[model samples]
Target: MSDESSNEAPRTVRLDRELVRALAHPMRNRILGLLRVYGPQTATTLAGRLGVNTGATSYHLRQLAEAGLVIEDDSRGNARDRWWKAAHQGTEFDKAELLDQEPELALGFLHGVGQSYAENIFSFIDAVQTMPADWRDASVLSDYFFHLRADQLDAMMQEVLAVLEKYKTADLTAPLPEGAEQVTVQLQAFPRETR
Candidate 1:
């Protein structure tokens, strides 16, 4: 399950049902999010920040590690102070992957992810709202929508994937231009017509 390939590039992994089930828990998802954004940390530290018992956090962390969604950080000073981080930078799952086995479960998981994203988006908006008017004025808003005829659906998907790959590999941590606020790049695509 480790996708660390030497010859090929790191591939986008699709979470299996068991792994998805493990991540369905709010605490586990939060733990993964924290590790991804802030790098490795011990379960005790995560528990303290999340206001939960270390034992509970440790159990969930173990499940994530077993599911191959996280990997232990052996660089930490002590063996007892186990640290963990996300196994992959990104993950993707198509509807077919879930629908074939359990439609309800897949739908539920997707709904949960959508809800979490919606909440995050609103929270970001609220944070920006509290900032100074001048700061808001300096921000930019962009919207792009277009329709193009394509001979094959696979081609369009490949094009979109290429664009995403560019951003995924880009130096996103670089400092922004003066007077410019953070920019949120959101990409969403769906079939315009069903055959």
Candidate 2:
């Protein structure tokens, strides 16, 4: 879902070559995502959650920070135990332009993003059995197929994002109700060439 407040549009940074290169690494992308979703965290804590060593996590965090995707959250920790947080609420990029300009880097970045999406889906599946009844009932993992022109597909996705923005607005305007939990809402819409 979107991350901005109801009063303001989401802050999205366009991907430049430097940022693309920084995020091409799967671990760096994961590190940035974790900081975004869960708030500021120390490298040690992130490493523990990511099943990696602190040194590696720290290195990735530094790379992300260098690209301005993340920043040290000095408010949260001491010098020795620095914390990191996402610099922007979201990111946007022209996929075609990137592909034409920096083919390898663009592909590597997209691959990491796709891998992350798959991991999120799989993690949810693995946890569904043990989730609370209410959450189980609320979750959805479904897809639809439709014949549409490229323009129509783009419009459909925009509408979907608008709805998600409504929910994100609600989140910022009020405190979440009891029992409310952070949920991952993923949207993937693409043409199927083979099928």
lDDT of 2 at 116: 98
Q: 69-132, model 1: which lDDT tens digit per residue?
A: 8888767749568888777655677778777877777777777677666666676677777878
lDDT of the structure predicted as candidate 1? 0.71
Candidate 1 versus the native: TM-score? 0.67
Runs off by more than 4 Å, candidate 1: 1-11, 48-51, 77-80, 130-161, 170-195
lDDT, each prediction: 0.71, 0.86
Winner by TM-score: 2
